[model samples]
Target chain A: MCKNALTEEKFRELDSYVDTLPEKHGMLISVLHRAQGIFGYLPKEVQLHVARSLNLTAAKVYGVVSFYSYFTEEPRGDHIINVCTGTACFVRGAEGILKELENHLGIKSGQTTPDGRFTIDALRCVGACGLAPVIMVDGKVYGRVKTGEVTGIVKEYAEV
Target chain B: MSAYRMHLLVCGGTGCRASESKLLAENLQALVMTAGMGREVQVVITGCFGFCEKGPIVKVLPDNVFYVEVKPSDAEEIVSEHVLKGRPVDRLLYVEPEQKGKVSSHGEMPFYKKQLRIALRNCGFINPEDIEEYISVDGYQALGKVLTEMTPEALVTLMKKSGLRGRGGGGFPTGLKWEAAARNRADVKYIICNADEGDPGAFMDRSILEGDPHSVLESMAIAGYATGARFGYIYIRAEYPLAVHRLEIAIAQAQQMGLLGERIFGTGFSFDIAIKFGAGAFVCGEETALIHSIEGERGEPTNKPPFPAESGLWGKPTCVNNVETFANVPPIILKGAEWFASIGSEKSKGTKVFALAGKINNVGLVEVPMGIRLREIIFDIGGGIRDGKKFKSVQTGGPSGGCIPASALDTPMDYENLTCIGSMMGSGGMIVLDEDDCMVNVAKFYLEFTCDESCGKCTPCRVGNKRLHEALTRITEGKGTMADLDNLKELGAIIKDTALCGLGQTSPNPVLSTMKYFWDEYLAHVVDKKCPAGVCTALLSYYILPGKCIGCTACKRVCPASCISGEVKKVHEIDQARCIKCGACLKACKFGAISKK
Candidate 1:
């Protein structure tokens, strides 16, 4: 398993954090956030860690994490890129930009580059409709981005 | 002694960030460092501050100086004047809409005056990545209470008294769902948090998970305790990378503290959580479909005779709740159940988190009491329509719900109230529609989304939604008869009645609601062969007004269709026959000559 993946010791570490938690319910989110910060993903051992920490059964943690669209277990790349494909962005040429990024990165949406330098993702809307064709790189947004500029923009991040 | 005792909190939500809040932070940090007062002056990048119209917001600690719309260039002046010299940044202060030049803090802002935020309590107060900050704010108190003081039965009773219901489309009593799972005699029960918020223009779940993942995790643990569940799962779409990352960190923190594993709080109970990734299938938002997807099957909803509570993951009794629903659990537990029941209307017991997006003055996440009127959310909280445009309709519940017209703005925003008015508060996505929005095209837009997101598990949802979309498309193109309208109503009702899952059942809501409220728009499309809002390409004609035409040849030069032929400073005539109604000339026109009718 990768270092980002979970381990028995990591599970213990997460479990210890849960024990220190004053409350039970709201801690799952924070615990998961911390786990990801440490392990970079919510793997099985990490999930086990979360379950033990929150005083929840593993299946319960699994069920809650699985039910939501905001929890993941897969290891992500170093840098993440999300291109908005909202109504406003769609009306603009967002699809062309996304396609160009996908081709340049040699990976589809939800996949990281083979070198683990970048992960490309498509989002619904980043609320920058006034500046359509918006792309967010690691929480920093670049608005009015063109398809032709995608490769150069991504390369800057990759080289970084 | 620490040189500077005061801290500065800046709004760093997507909205504020878009308005150069990060740049502002950088400038302030740089200025503070240069002034050699960096150690004492702490800057915290917090979540949504709610008064989005006045963002990027900056709040000074101790004095509580709330500054609104602070630009990057203004940051150095704020630091130099406020941080170093003890003078406030007067110019960037928030000016109230009603009282011009009167500045106020977030507490004094009218947008937050009438609002009560439980789900959004920790959002703007804490750094989302830090568990300690959340802990200081009493983050996991409910989980501790549940584990130490309350039994499964007692917890269920408290929930029942609270009248807490699912915030994820279905307003089913949360206590009852827990009770169902509690009553089920199973060795391995499960709790599921439904974070797969697939509704169009919806981000309530995403924001909660991002802003406060700990709350959801802690609540699910409480649910596990109440329902006698041995495990939990959070089924989130692969899209929300930030939320996912935060959740992962929270889980690790929980585990490290020994709150999750065997013998938590010296108790014998043991529970664990895992995350399952979604491929952006909208239908998976449904409980049964979600359960099926988690079980390594296709994400399609099965019949409810054996509901997930009866037979869920691995054919076990499972209690499933949405992200918003789970978020409410901790508060209900910490604060008495009756305390939760006190707020909102009688039927709905608590606040609802809505993504107040599209043509609204305040386009961000908002949490309001259930009984609050749509008028309050749209006009007051949302600061009314953008650009002084008249409000036409507001689409709630994504593509599955109906368009609520301005006449129904006073309607209470509870589950039953919204449903009674031909709209359901499905996932709390309220897309504000302006006068420029064509109702016919709006229905078509939602229909198209439904058709695409449909899981194709049932014939009614798969085929019926597509046909409805086709009819709406036909009407938009001015090629439909009144018969098409009748057919839509008939087909819509059938899909609702016969569809196996909620996706199909509510898919026809937009078409039905628009037909009821904006029937004139539909009639204009069919009878007059015109798009009243000029949204439908086939029904629209781009023409340059004779008097207003500058005849600068700008329209002709920019027209991709070559549809305009005119002389300079003379009457410009658009060749309507040749015009594709692309509106290129309309956008390029300098003298406001072009018109689409």
Candidate 2:
């Protein structure tokens, strides 16, 4: 049932980490956190491995992975571009900024580039609405960004 | 800290940090040290000062001199003029929009004058990462007092006396919920602080956790002691990395100091708290959904007759309170219940911290007494709408909230009054919409959020909100029919009455409230097929003014759709059918010839 999602080394590491957890009952969330940290994103095979270790159903693990917006099954790009679509940011022109990014990168939201260098996604709020129309390229935050600036921001991470 | 004669507090909250306030802090500290005032003067990076409009704020202590829009370059002048020569920099001082003179002290400023800070008491004051700073401001004093003196019953009774309602949209009485959980005897009960503040513009919970993590930890431990529970969980959002870091540091610091984790204050109670990260879900803001999420399951709300207080977490009695509500607890226990309850209106007591953003001039956070007029918050604290524009509406309660129009600006903003006006206190996200904002578009925006966020658990929220968003989209695209309006009102009522959780029930608030107040705007969208605020692009058509047109080929060259055609230096004509409405032609026109109607 594990399906050999990971190498023997990776599997052993995950097993040892799970062993360190104080309680085993509700450790799926913590395990998921570690999996995401290690693999960047959770694939079906990886999720199956987690379920097998935790003695949980595959359906149960998949249900959780799909429920939260944070957990993604697809492989992420090298740099993830997060555009804040919070009400505050939206009103202050996040839509146009997103459109600008889409135009510059030749990709829509939730889609990665062919080169797998960048992926653009719109978030509900990063709790930084005070700086509306905010964008986070990787973990670096850019705020008060004008529509004209989107191309420059995208160009910085463009393929050489 | 005591050796320093004066301290320069630079705001290091998310808002300020975005504007390079951390760099400013470093420059100030380095500049201060360069001047040989190393031990005498200290530079501290504090949390949000709340007035983010003129953010990257630097406040000098003792003198109470406040500076706005402070830059890293200004560090040289500030250190030389203020520290060495003992003179406040006049150019760097915060200039009141109304008054001509400098507003030095933060207290005298119009923005903070009408406000009362209880939950946000230490937000702009203390260094959030430093436990010592939180301690200096009397942080964990309440936890000590509660553990030493008050019993579970007595603390619950005191909370009941304080009349503090849940700040997390529900507005449920905090004390009553605690009493319910305390009454239900269990071998192991649970206390969960709902830091899952999913509301878009609302960052008050995040601010409290980032600014004063101890208050929430202390409050949770107090809840554990009061509710006869030994374990607690703080379900915070992972989006707030700064708050999460501070919380982890604070939790570890508390454990080391014997504030948390076994035998608190040398008492018999052994209450400990752990951090549980919420993977982005708006519905999880609901208590039942939150409980399910913590259980490592899909976050969806179930029918609640046997509420979380009766049976929660692992089928044991549990108490869940909002972050702001928990933040208020430590203060309530520190000061008497009467003192906490004395402020605000008759029904609602104490203060509410709002993440005031959007068209407001002062776009940050503000804590004001309940029952305070909307006019006061909008005009006084918020510094009125941005660019001196006419106030359109203020949306409260996130997606679950309705808009309060400019006509009702004078209305009191307590829970009951807000509900009466088809709005709620919501997690205190008072996003001010200006005349530039289209009400139809605004309603559509909120509906779109709820529709995407609705956990498909119930038919009403899942299908109903989706249909509502579809209808709004049709209207915005200038294809709405008269029947759509009727369908909206009817469906909104159904969703409100039948939805399983609090989130689903209030999902239609934006639709209902917008239609109620801005009826004419909706009618305009349906009948005239025109978005009054020029927000809807489908309703807009680009036309060239013959009189102003200089036959510039710029319009034709830039037009991606190849719809614009005319000779060079002549009037360009755009084919209505062929036009993509991308606005490239309009932007290309330098003579102001192209205009969209």
Each predicted model: what fraction of the native A–B Cα contacts (within 8 Å) does it retain?
A: 0.06, 0.66
TM-score of model number 2, chain B = 0.97
TM-score of each prediction: 0.82, 0.97
DockQ of each: 0.09, 0.71
Model 2 misplaced regions, further than 4 Å: A1-7, B568-570
Docking class of 2: medium
lDDT of 2 by residue, B1-597 (tens): 688999999998888888889899999999888889889998988878888778789999879999999988899999999988889999988888877778888789998899899999988788888888888888889888888887889999999999999999878999999999999978999999999989999998988888888889889998988889999999988888999998999999989999898788888989888999999999999999899889988888878888999999988999999999998988898888999889999999999999999988888899999989999998888888778788899999889889998889999879999999998888999889988899999999998888889999889999999999999999999999999999999999999999999998998999999999999999999999988887899988889999999986998998888888899866779899998788998777788988887
Chain A TM-score relative to the true structure, per candidate: 0.85, 0.91
Give per-residue CA lDDT, model 1, range B338-436, as digits (tens). 799999998998999887767776666788998899999888877788788899998898878999998999998899999998989899888888887
Highest-TM-score candidate:
2
True lDDT of residue B461, candidate 1: 90
Top DockQ model: 2
- The interface root mean square deviation of candidate 2 comes to 1.1
Output the lDDT of residue B34, model 2. Answer: 82
Best by lDDT: 2
